[model samples]
Target: MTPLHRVGSALAIAVALSLVTACTAPAPTPSPTPTIDDSAANTPPPTPAESVAPAGGSDPTCETIIPAATVEDFESLGWSAEQDDFRVGATIIDGGLQCVWADHAGPATDHVQIFGWAPIEQDAAYDAQDNLVGEGWVREDQPDGVYITENPETTISTDENGYGMTYLFGDGWVKVADTKQGLLLVVWGD
Candidate 1:
């Protein structure tokens, strides 16, 4: 065959080989779209921040890390500690402790989360603050609790739809406090 014909044949063979390879390839699996049902619509989503397990040799627990919020603690702060309105989520992660508390009785949803770790080598406080900021909480000079002198301002109302205005907790995130264990951080939000 002429040189031109041989070149054309080689090109045709290459195209045919590619076509066969493509046709024989397995079809890609389609990823299912995540769906939220009506029941799940009201369920609060997990915090968007990726919680890092505690590092170093320190190990913390919910009991050791979370501060006690007594009935008086709630009442004095203008929050009812009644079980009906109080909900808590606490867990140990990466040898560290994380605890969250919320009063769901009101029309709005607000929560207080405390994180504790020992040794205080890394910037856990800064990380917590960054996580809260990333979650869209606006920073304030002081949390409403700080300004309360006597009784907390009562603004409770029946939330027929159960949707109330969200308020960030504490003066701000990264409330780093020194304790016997190490560093403690308190963050509050909806």
Candidate 2:
């Protein structure tokens, strides 16, 4: 072959060798992660302590779950709710009321809402990151069996270009705690 043809042939052979080497290369092994599978062991999922509600048809609110004294203390710490709306409904629990407070007076200026859940809703809370499940907020665990949102820096806005109301956590934190009485207390603030 002419020198040019020889050089071209050599390049072709080199390319072919590289392609063959790549095709034969072993794939990287994935590191195994520890996982718990109760089904495999024939063990059922552990159930949480049964939560009971207070006597009567009363609905739990933030004020109910959190003591009045505690609410005052929080207000002293710059968390103030000017107007609050409370409604008895099944938003969190059967016959439970949900409360929403708006235009808070504080450095964060956040809106607050509270919810109470029954034992039936225990699984929902455990599975949820927020007071309500599947709202885009991330769930974090506390030492006291409480599930709260991780850095819920959401803002409520009407502007479509801006973050809308669905991002309701606000520019602080949203906390949910199961009160043994089937009550889930939620607070939005710093």
Candidate 3:
């Protein structure tokens, strides 16, 4: 045989051997499927001794003021509750319960703050409505009281306004909700 033919034959044999080796190689073991622990999500919030009352209004615990289902819904959205004294417009009324739910890992504007004052006098409720109106908030009269809001229409999450503030004045209660990141606050008073 010619020298060139022998070299060509050797190259063909090497290529055939490589193909056979690759075909016989063992298949790699796949990583075990990861298990997610969702126990925290199912856990319920603590229950306090008594229901919340505005009289002398010692600041109510987060558990007392917010419902378990509400808190769970917020938690599902990666938000957690923080209880603190909150400011509404230009006033910080005493003896009110404030609960703010926010994604601590996210931006500062991603939060929902709710301030509720019960057993409020009529005069104070009117004063709060007036204060919000003076700050360019629109007022709508409800059968029980008034509903005042910075933006009357629903806000989109990407809107430049960033947040919306709403005040609900009822018979003996007043609630202020400052919401951003597309959160909705619905409060009912007894």
Best by lDDT: 3
The lDDT, on a scale of 0 to 1, for candidate 1 is 0.33
Per-residue lDDT of model 1, residues 23-131, tens digit only: 9999999965322122222334324242232356334444333233332343444443221111111211232233332343545643432233332213543454345
lDDT of 3 by residue, 15-56 (tens): 999999999998999965322233432444233232334467
Flag regions of model 1 displaced more than 4 Å: 1-59, 66-94, 100-124, 141-190
lDDT sort, best first? 3, 2, 1
Residue-wise lDDT of candidate 2 within 11-115, one digit each (tens)? 999999999999999999996532212121132312332223345855555565443544565455445433233211124334333344333543343334333
If both were scored by lDDT, which would come out higher, candidate 2 or candidate 3? Answer: 3
Better of 1 and 3 by TM-score: 3
lDDT of 2 at 124: 44
Q: Candidate 2 — which residues are off by over 4 angstroms?
A: 1-63, 70-92, 102-120, 126-135, 150-190
Instruction: Tell me which residue pairs clash in candidate 2.
Output: 52-181
